[model samples]
Target: MVFVALLGTGTAVAGQVRGPAVVPLPPQPALPQLPWLPPLPPVPSISVQALPPFDVEPLDLDLESIGDSAQEAVLQSLQALGTLRESASVSVLGSLQDGFAFRFSQQQPPRDRTEARAEALYRSARESIDRGRYENAIQELDRLIDLPGTSRVDAALYWKSYTQAKLGQRAEALTTLADLEKRFANSRWLKDAKALEVEIRQASGQAVSPDSQNDEELKLLALRGLIQSDPDRAVPMIERLLDGNSSVKVQENALFVLSQSQSARALEIIAKTARGAVNPDVQLRAIRYLGAIGGPENRQVLDEVYRGSNDAALKRAILRAFMTGGDRARLLALAKSETSPELRAQAIQQLGVLHATTELADLYRNESSAEMKKRVLQAMLVGGDADRLIELAKSEKDVELRRAAIQNLGLMAAGRTGEALKQLYSSDASADIRREVINALFVQQNAGVLVDAARAEKDPAMKKEIVAKLSLLRSKEASDYLLELLK
Candidate 1:
């Protein structure tokens, strides 16, 4: 039966193997069949219509048709946007006024009316005296003396006396000098007062010979008179004094007298003394005199002395003379070819004083030595060559040289320098370079750029450094940034 069942079912029963009999199973319940359902209807065939392409036209927004309030709002929004853009640009580029406008204002406290009047009177009196308008000077001096609490009273009195003496009113001058002595016993003008008294008394027929006088000051006065009276005679006397073992004061006075003379002999004597023919002290003085009395001849003398002498001190003096004589060509030649770095640097410095910006830029380009380049950079700075400095700061490959250029840019006033520093801070990746830029901006008091940089900086330490710099600033931009930080 189990075999018949297995054949009918086409299955093998567990435990029905040949060695074991199958246990009789309990009666199984009949299987229930599920109800049959019809097939789903064919899916509906829907077609999508292809529409023609529509052109998107711009809206014709007629602002005139809008309500007044709406139009006003739009205008305000545009203006605000414009202002924001302009402010952003200004922060980055710095203001035109900062660069072009006069930055300096009168910081001196306003003088009170009384003080002002006194000063005006004193100044006018001195100017009048200088112009040989003794009467006008006397008038101004009297007014100054009459002013209450005038500090220039002593000065006015001394000048009034001098003016009187110049005007040949010797008696009136002596009386004025006496008044000065009585009023200000411990005054600095007392020495001048005594000298004036002697001068006035001498003019009053008490003629004292300059040669007999032991006073160096009196001798100098007499020498001045002699030079004015007879320059030819004074030149020989000055040469004798310079050549002799006279005191340096006497020699310097003689040199000064010689400088005032336009005579050829005077020039020759000055040239000789400047050539170290005299004492070292006198030679140095003569070199200075040559600079003060600048001319083609004086410059030639200076050049000859510079080449002939190996003395560093004298060469340096000649360099100064070259500047004073306005011999830029000579200075440039020395700055370019001088073997002594010290003297070359000195020549470059003198060029700076002469505001030789073009020459300095040329020198910087041709220079190979780092130290010499730095000196040239300094000279450029002194010459106010901001454009060149900006160029170097941007393109110089030497890290230290670039840093130097950046540092010099900081010392300059705001405007282009501030803009260049902002750009450097934005583009440079070197932490050290960026740090230098930050320092430069701080030096320029350019808080606007500093604030902008701080906003854009990602490094925490760098940002902190920028913030620290901001804290020291007193600008509106810096204050606003700090307030924003608090919020």
Candidate 2:
């Protein structure tokens, strides 16, 4: 049976499918009527080339397919995915295929017939090992490793060690694994090799670390074993690895193993490392892992980091960490109080990304800086605050701020957005703002409104501009309306 690896560890119990989430609409206040365009001044003939390019590059609509190298069982599973009615199952299947495709693409291709034969032999050896024919597997793997043209000697070496260990050749197996490690440093089998080596050492009553040597890889191997069998014992070793002695790669791996542990001591060590690691990369890694293993405590630590660190980069990282942790209260507080206006704007934008509409609108209401208020308008758009945007369009006193509101409203194709634009067009006396409203209607591709407006318009310049905008639309209805205007 094919099993899809889920993103999280928790088992999903099938639950009842629910309807779409209902967003509660905010109350819109009454809008005032604006003056219509005044009587026509003489229209200067405008060239159509002055308009912006209308044709955009369309996105690829082709469906992605499974790679040809997929195993038969995997291919069958993908084929059956279309019949699944549940969204959950479809999501799981999609992730599985994506993961499989990535791994399949990473596999090295055989160079020639010699390499192909070596791979076949290697597969046969793996089959032998699975069937408990250790001697035969070892013989086959050794032969493959000795072949001059074999591209998969790393795999052959790994399986040889595995089969040797199966036959109780611990010392020989360890030697073979060392050879594999030294020769194939970039091999994908390195992690499994390290794991198997550690297992063999433990089973043979050999110490994980000998008294004389400081082998970093061996220690890392031992650390991995302890994390699984006894995470309490693993914490100190992990802390040691994080202490500027180990390479960044080893330290990051240590952080990954530490994150996997469920022990309170493990979490405490992670928090401590996140706070105190002098290495910025290590510190960043710990912070990200803390975000992944989120809780109130982790959120508090990030909040403290944001308050204490003067490093803009570190503060930015903390902002993202808080975003990941879903600490909206902290984010809102930062958005309000951050001394740096740029970071304050970033925090407000993150709040929008998190869909904190009420808080964002509140910020917009009190925001004193013109530039910062524009950012707030952008945040409202990101948060899908259509009603709030309409309200801002109607109520904003600053002309530029109101323009910003109307501009973002154009991004929405909703009928309400079009209606808000029409209302603004009728109420505001500024021709420039009315032109903006017409541009917004163009953005919504509302040709019918443009036709009606064009028909009723007395200002020849405004009418010409409306027709020019209408010329951008390619729909049959838009074409028919333009023909009628010409007639």
lDDT of 2 by residue, 1-487 (tens): 1111112125689999999999999999889998898764333222111111111011111112332222222322322321221122322432332222211211122233344446457657756865678899988888789888556688788778867876789999999999999998976567667766776786598665442123555566677678889887888888776763453345656777788788988888788877853445557778887876889998888778777777554676677677667778988999989998657866886676566788998898788987778778766665567899899888888978777677667656535577777778777888877887776666566777777778777889888888876776556777898788678
| Candidate 1: regions farther than 4 A off | 1-216
TM-score of 1: 0.56
Per-residue alpha-carbon lDDT of candidate 1 for residues 1-487, written as tens digits (9 for 90 to 100): 0000001114566785466667999999998998889763232211101100000111112343455444334333322322222234322212221112111112112233354456557656755754567799899899889887666688788888877877789999999988999998976567657766776787788876463223544555666778878998877877776765443445666688778888888888998999875555468779987887888888988989999988665787788777767789999999998998768877987676577788888888898998788777766665567888899989999988888788667667666578888999999989888988887776667899999999999999999888877876679999899999999
Q: After superposition, how far is residue 254 of candidate 2 from its true place, in Å?
A: 2.6
Clashing pairs in 2: 33-427, 34-426, 34-427, 34-428
Go through the candidates in order and give each one's C-alpha lDDT.
0.68, 0.65
